[model samples]
Target: MQNALKELILQMADDALVLGHRNSEWTGIGPMLEEDLAFSSMAQDKIGHALALYTILHEHMGEPDPDKLGFMRKEEEYRCCQFVELPIGEYDFTLARHFLYDHAELIRYEMLVNCPFEPLAQMARKVRGELKYHVLHADTFLRELARGTEESKARMQAAIRYAWPYALGMFEITDADAQLAAAGAYAGEKERRSRWLSTVSSIINDAGLQVPEPDEAKAIYGGRKGYHSEYLKPLLDEMTEVVRLDPTAEW
Candidate 1:
């Protein structure tokens, strides 16, 4: 039970760390100044969340320090979903991905709020509050973009189609998932995915967009098992560059 709980926490931490890095890449590159600030703020929130989770692991669960676990791992050691490893392609794709991913994250944390694990449940309560604003930001942008001119709408729709499969990958089930669920440490990916679909569908419908059919959506998996896309290796290399240069040096 403890091992399963640790696995769940590590996956969540990895997801936040990677996606936060991706989002931070937009710091000065967002299409609009407001979006730039918003994404940057969210990026900070995500990385902070990752650090908090890692601290829990280190302080209570006997895991290594957060820096070592986050920066010293080999690419294959990461358990983040393929959805977060991909580069932020464009504003439209980034927006769509953010919208889909955060909704799923929100639901996951909401379930975690009542977890049997006391530390995790406490963390979940805080995380769920932060995610409310994230979903609000994503929803506001999605609605505005979807209702804009033809070009903006087309771009959003295309991004939605392209990201939907990878977004589904965020919910890839693992053997440990059952253990976690049975232990009441988590609600499991299946329930989260179901709620995600319903929530995202409603938002998409309100934005005058069509939700991709689940049967037809091919989820890209394997990240939880240590497999990743071609992009992750390079991203990890970049992420660890400074840390690798001087592992003994204090930040």
Candidate 2:
């Protein structure tokens, strides 16, 4: 059970860390000033969440310290979903990915709020609260862009279609899923995916956008098992550069 929980925690932490880095890349290059700040703030929240989760693993589960766990992992050792590792392409594409991703996150954390694991449950409650604003920000921008103009709608729809497969990969099941679910440690990805589809479909339909049919979408998987796109290697190199340069140095 401890091993299963550790795997879950590591995956969640990796997801947050990788996506936070991707979002932070937009700090100075967002479509506008407000958006730049918004993404940056959310990035900070995500990285903070990752740190907290890693701390739990260190203090309770005998894992490496947060810094080493976060910054020194091999590329194949990472368990982040491929969706978060993908580069933030364009404004519309990034917005679409953010909308899909955060809804899943919000639902996942909500499920974790009642988990049997006390430490994780407490952390979930706090993280879930922070995710509310992330959902709000993504929903607001998605709605406006989807309903704004013919071109905006077209671009958003295209972006959604392009990102849909990767978004589905966010729910890739793991061998430990059954054990975790049975133990009430988590509600499992299958349930979360169902709720996520319902929520995102409603938001998309209400905003006059189309939700890609699940039957027609192919999920891109394997990231949770350490397989990743070409992009992840470069991203990891950049992420760990400072730490790797001086492992003995302290902040």
Candidate 3:
């Protein structure tokens, strides 16, 4: 159970850290100034979430500092899902990632809200507060894009198509999954993924957008086992370059 708890915390910490790095790409390039500020706020939230998760990891797992865990890890050693490491190619693509991740995250954290592990349960409560606004931001875009110009709609659909597989992969299970479930870490992953798809699909359909092709549309894999797309390395390099340079330096 202790190992299970550590792995579970690592899962959250890695995902939040990588996603924050990817989201930060929008710092100066978000579609509009308001969105720029808004997405950057989201990025900050992700980083902050990672920080909180890391604090727990250190205290409970006897792990190294969070910076060492986050910055020094090899790509293949990081436990983050593929969805976060994906390239934020265009506005729609970035938003699609946000939409998919925000929805997945809502369910994920909601599950954690009742985790048998106290630290995770407490962290989930904190993360859920921030993610409430995140869901609104992403869902607002989802609605607008679904009803906007044909081009916006089409692009959003394409982004949805591209990310749906990785999005499913976000809920991919691991060895700890069973123990987590047995210990009520967050319900079983299979059940949780089912709920996730239904919630996300319902929102898309309600927005008048086409239902995303099902997770079975493709392999719907990776990131659970440390495998990531080609886009991951460069992103991590940039994100950790400073930290990498001065491993012994204090912030």
Candidate 4:
């Protein structure tokens, strides 16, 4: 009913779409068999969530196809955080991304579950139910990796370092976040971000890992503004090419 809601919905839709594609990159390349399955399944869930969100956006926008919105959007038009577009690092890195994202989704969706908008709140509740399992799966793996062999520990630490800045990208404090909260589409971002950082920092400390200082003034930016890394375009081209091949073709 409002442009604010439209933009807010699209931001979530696009974030899930791109992040799902990024997660999908590890379909067969994970360090272990268990990890391969875990990452692949996580990617599936992210993509599934993206589909649901995009379907909502499509209906609201009077669009016909969800695939077009996910696949056909130009790079600069995408609203996915830069964190999702970065190349997949080792299994450790993969876990880092998963651990941060799943927990953040849990918090974000928990807030959204009570949104003023009934349809969006319903979707948030549905996705939050699924994210419960996703977060656990990631959390278990992160703990094991932290307590595993020396090599595993080193790699996990390195992954955490690599993933730290990107993790911050998850909190895109833009007009969209404000608008959504103002419209009752979501709880405010400020509170959510603080809770997320504290939650994540505790996990890091428990893992015997070090978390560097947090200076919001020094944080990296761009995903919210649509400037992504080199990884996004190629990923999207492969992801969307088949759909774009014949836009009228029915599944």
Candidate 5:
């Protein structure tokens, strides 16, 4: 039970941390001034979410401190999905990724609101509030851009298609999933993925965008198993550079 819970928490925390950093990259250079602040704000929220999850691991699961767990781990030790690690590409791609990823996150947290695990359930209830706005931001941008000029619609569609497979990978099942679900600690990834599809499909269709068929879209996998793209190592290096420079330094 402990191992299963740890696996689940670690994955969630890593996803938030990596994507938070990616989102932070857009802090000053968003396509527009409003979007610039919006991404920056969301980035802060994600990192805060990561820190909270890491704290749970430290307090309950015998893991290292949140800072060590976040920055001192070897690249392969991190469990974030590859989709989050992908470079924040063009605005369309970033927006598409955000739309797909946050929908899954929102649903996942909603499912966990009543988890048997008290610490996680408490955290989920709080985090979901923030996620509501993240999803709203993504939804609004997606709908408006998809309904905009021909080029905007085309770009949004292409970005969605490109991100589909990787997004599916976010729900890659693991041995720990069955244990967690049976224990009533989580609803499992399959269920969350189902809910996510139903929720996002309607929005995508409403935006005049084609929802990628799950059966036809091959889910990109491996990050959950600690196998990552070349992108992850460099990202890890840059993120941990400060910590490495002076391990004893206090934040």
Candidate 6:
């Protein structure tokens, strides 16, 4: 039970940490100044959330302190889904990924708000509150872009299609998922995926976009098992550079 819970927490924390850095990449380069500030703000929120979850692990699960657990892990030891590890490509693709991911995240935390694990449930309540803003930002961009010129609609559609499979990969079930669900620690990935699909499909259709057929979009899994694309190791190297430079420095 404890191991399953630990796995669940690690996966969530790793996902937040990696995606936070990816979002931070847009701090100065976003196409517009408002968007630039928005992504930067969201990036801070994500990293803060990661730190909170890592602290939970340290407090309850006997893991190392948040700093060590976050920066010292090898690429293969990080449990973030491969979807978040991919380079933030064009703006359309990034927005599409954000739309897909934040909705799923909101749903996952919503499910956990009343979970049996008091520590996690307490955190989930706080996370769900913050996630609402993320979903709103993603949804607004998706709709506005899809309703723009023909080229904008076409690009948004293409980006959504391209992101669909990888988005599904976000819910890849782990070995511990079943145990987590059975023990009331979590509701499991399948349930979250189901709710996410329904929730996002409605928004996508209303925005004049097509949600790709699930059968045709084969999820790009394996990340839950510590398997990742070539992108992750490089990302980790960059993220941990400061820590490596001066491990003894106090935060």
Off by over 4 Å in 3: none
The digit string of per-residue lDDT tens for model 5 on 194-241 reads 999999999999999999889634999888889887889999999987
lDDT for model 4? 0.78
Model 5 residue 224 lDDT?
86
Q: What are the per-model numbers of colliding residue pairs?
A: 0, 0, 0, 0, 0, 0
lDDT accuracy of residue 143 in candidate 1: 98
Candidate with more favorable, higher TM-score: 2 or 3: 2
C-alpha RMSD values across all candidates: 1.0, 1.0, 1.4, 1.8, 1.0, 1.1
Which run of 10 residues does model 2 get worst, by summed lDDT? Answer: 209-218
Number of the top candidate by lDDT? 5
Ten contiguous residues with the weakest lDDT in model 3: 212-221
**Candidate 1 Cα lDDT to native:** 0.92
Against the hidden true structure, what lDDT does model 6 obtain?
A: 0.91
Residues 1-251 of candidate 2 have per-residue lDDT tens digits of 78888888888999999999999999899999999999999999999999999999999999899999999889999999999999999899889988999999889889998888899999999999999999999999999998899999999999999999999998999987888988889878889899999999999999999999875249999998999999999999998788787889995
Worst 10-residue lDDT window for candidate 5 reads 215-224
Per-residue CA lDDT of model 1 for 22-56, tens digit only, reads: 99999888998999999999999999999999999
- lDDT accuracy of residue 38 in candidate 5: 96
Clashing pairs in 1: none
TM-score of candidate 6 on Cα atoms, chains taken together: 0.97
lDDT score, residue 168, model 5?
95
Could you tell me the lDDT of residue 95 within candidate 3?
91
Which stretches of candidate 6 lie above 4 Å from their native place?
none
Worst 10 residues of 6 by lDDT: 214-223
lDDT of 3: 0.83
- Deviating ranges (above 4 Å) for candidate 5: none
